[model samples]
Target chain A: MIRTLLATIALALWQTAALAQTNHQHVSGSACGEAVLRCASKVTPAFAPDGTLWLAWLAGGQVSVASSKDGGQTLSAPVAVTKLPLNLDTGPDARPKIAIDRNGGIAVAFAIFKDKAFNGQVFATRSADGGKSFAEPRPITSSSESQRFETIGVDADGSVFAAWLDKRNRIRAQQSGRKYEGAGLFFASSKDGGATYAEARLASDNTCECCRLGLAFAGPGRPVVVFRNIFEGGVRDHAVVSFADPATAGEVRRVSNDDWRIAACPHHGPSLSISAAGTYHVTWYSNGKARKGLFYARSQDEGRTFSEPLALGRPDRNPARPYVLAGPRGTVMVWKEFDGERTAVNVTISHDEGRSWTKPVAVATTKDTSDHPLLVSDGHKAYLSWMTKADGYRLVPVGDEP
Target chain B: MKRRLLAAIFLLGSLVAAPGADTTSDFKLKPFGRGSWQEVLRAHAGRPTLVHFWGATCGPCKVELPLLGKFMKEHAGIEVVTISADLVPDLPGATRAMLEKAGLRPAENWIFSDGFVERLRFEIDPTWQGDIPRTLLIERDGTITTIEGSAEIPVLEQWSTRQRAAPK
Candidate 1:
């Protein structure tokens, strides 16, 4: 009898240890409520200048930042970037964006709910001491009109650029008894790190309001932004705007001719990366007549024109949310595909500046709902960050294991 | 002491084995200015009802709203209720203004409350993926037909004709 009892106790102890190990490997930080858990799924990863991986996610009305020194194998405890009451809009196209400056300065921009109206204001916060602490958030847009779906980036000169969907024009048009076809794309920049921002300037008007904006540095202080623009006849094509001076309105150029003239929200946006040879690599989703799936294209003359759109993924699979990252050796594109019963995160790599791409490799699969896969690079190595109902959150290195 | 330990284990096991809270049937939709879906459905319980889900930012919704509005005005016996699926806490005014511009401001217009959107969506249709500009036609006998994309006029007209021919 004593021998049987001892065996039973040993088995129980072994199971307890295994359970603890599993939980520690998956769950990060404290447990959140169900609503916050869903809200916390949308994550953005950034690589600091010193090769530190920084991830920002929304949890329980706060924007939290966690750093992983060992290439995302282990993460430090999350530090609150802002403690104010935040109405975080978390989804495939809406989440908090983080940018690490060249001098180790950290900046985060997010959308906060207004008091009376169901509108949002773009707010930004910065940290000088790495990600240890953050300063008070300041409104990026001066006007009280609705502003959301912001994307932030830092240039080589430490200048912070933020572009978002602005509704000031819509409100003004309403006052004038005219219809503003869609929201306007506006931007603001901070020269001396993230201390203060200049007045917002309009990049373009009639932009699709629901899709996220993509921003990448083209030159020293010039940052290029890509968004869905509402062209004539309501064609929702992609437009590129290069802000040579953030205080002034720059020229807006149409990059893709995939005239996707639809009257619906795809909820998918474009991703951009500048190669070492000064070529701009962009990937976006569209069901146009010419291009019918996720596509990749490159512009050699800085968004003036683009190459032929190359379709990615299989024809039968429904792929959405494509993300691109340009490393020193190659460019990687990651997207999610849903095949009726299962969802898979797939990746395709290009070594010749997106002129050609390899066959897509499925990195992860889940039978439940999952967030869009994100790609972040440290100029040498590219990593994929994903969150799912089955695996919680994972930051895995892509293209490192052959 | 052994018996107490066994009892404690039994209680813990029962607590863990119990099912989660039932949130599927919580169908309380708030009023959007005046009317709610519940009241509209109850008033026309025996008649066919059409529920249209739309968002202000959706491009396809812009094209479909006017068509739906015209259909509603032309058809008399069919009950049409439009619901704005805009992120409840972010853009209700925009949605309302857009609907007004599109002439889709029906008397039974409504918007989902902030948060719990997934739960409410599941309650509406378990298989729905929350796509915008979706249409649903409910027959008099409680049969529901959900169309993901925009519904054509002929589809609605046929459904309306069948609904009228059914027994009251």
Candidate 2:
């Protein structure tokens, strides 16, 4: 009986090894020709709070979203989430984003291209039935056009927060939808599952444009937004603010004081991941005159303040587009490094809070092509998604070992 | 008669003094102006005009434009042009000079002259919020056939070769 049990155990182990080496289908049919525009700025995929993957990309001058259930294996046909007409002037690299509610509903948002200018407007669509179908996209800001850099976040209670860098009331009046806004962060919310949103509120002001806005839910209905702020003398630094109800009211606060100074837009932004105990881990890219590095900081008391940012990458190669996600095992941070003509994705892991980090591993390779990578983690298994040099995309799974 | 002659001379002189008179009207392409976008598009009306909008600062556009030059040369009877939207003032006496250095000189070249920028915006797609190195393939009937931010050599070559072989 003991011999027979040993043989069965060996057989099981062999099966497990075989499955791990199994190759995952990396590329599907290319969205080429008129269906998908040819550009460096392409699709960005994220997982819904319900483990279903969602992809958002620009197609035919409009933003679109598609869903996948089998862990990025197969995708549903893309659906037009932006109701804006085909002639609406949308810009490149301003991808649409989606966040999932506690009940598994989804909220999607992106900017609009208008009037010989990218008069950036934020629009949101909701899927109450867990993405079976999405409700029509509705405008979240006033009709008076302004340049906006918008992002969305949903909490456990289904409250939604959409934040953007608004420039309607700035003194200098920067170019709409092109340059960094010289104003504060504006927000609108939906408590009834994104069916209706509150009037726009000023969360914070004096934020940079070109930098992306990030949002992470702290608790039942409270969420926080992290973005690069433009301080005095055109310094670009990272900042965070919280929403008391997130569904209503204008409760926003700045969380950090890096004070990095620069004259040009970095085209990089901050990313956030919230722990179960409401700890906020924010990572951003900074290259001031004094120093330049990828910095990471954490806030234990719900983003009241943050620890000093720990620089991860080397000085010679500045990392771009750093993404952080707090998984069940630990916090995962991923970024891309440009090496002359090639680009590579790097991932660093931390297990004991943000105290320590693992050796960074390369996830994807870009051999002489502009590869814009995006990452999404479902609190357990993290996936790295990026466009390849040959007009393709990849999804790399970084799961903790047993 | 003498007074009328003076008035006509004054009128012609004023028309020359008007801004954009040289470019906005009767802006013909010269022999040295190889790959001029306007002349090529006007000559090849009703056929697809493959325009490669390039810039000196853009790396991708640099590589893509040379391949386009060779491709246009190889495929006879195919009309292709490149618009060099280089800042005219920044490269004083250097606009045509740099085209030679960059090897972008083909049969018809058009450096977006002063005042032509606004006119092209209205002529083509008004909704075109200007992005650099933009590639536009307009069909024969003046309708935009394909519009994109960038193009690869293989894809463009294949598409143009196929169209060249197709029946008119």
Measured against the true two-chain complex, the DockQ scores of the candidates, in the order shown, are 0.09, 0.02
Top candidate when judged by DockQ against the true structure: 1
TM-score of chain A of each: 0.87, 0.81
Docking class of 1: incorrect
Show model 1 residue runs off by greater than 4 Å: A1-39, A115-117, B1-51, B55-131, B135-168
Error of 1 at A381 (Å): 0.3
Per-model lDDT: 0.71, 0.58
Tens-digit lDDT track of model 1 for A149-256:
898888777888888999899989989999877689988888856656788888888998778888887777778888888899878888888776656557788888
Which digits, one per residue and each the tens of the lDDT, describe model 2 over residues A82-173? Answer: 43323221222356777776667777776653221223556667877766677765666653445456777766656777777776656334
Candidate 1 Cα deviation (angstroms), residue B158: 10
Lowest summed lDDT over 10 consecutive residues: which window, candidate 2 chain A?
A20-29
Clashing pairs in 1: A118-B90, A263-B59, A263-B60, A264-B59, A264-B60
Question: Comparing chain B with the reference, what is the TM-score for each candidate?
Answer: 0.73, 0.62
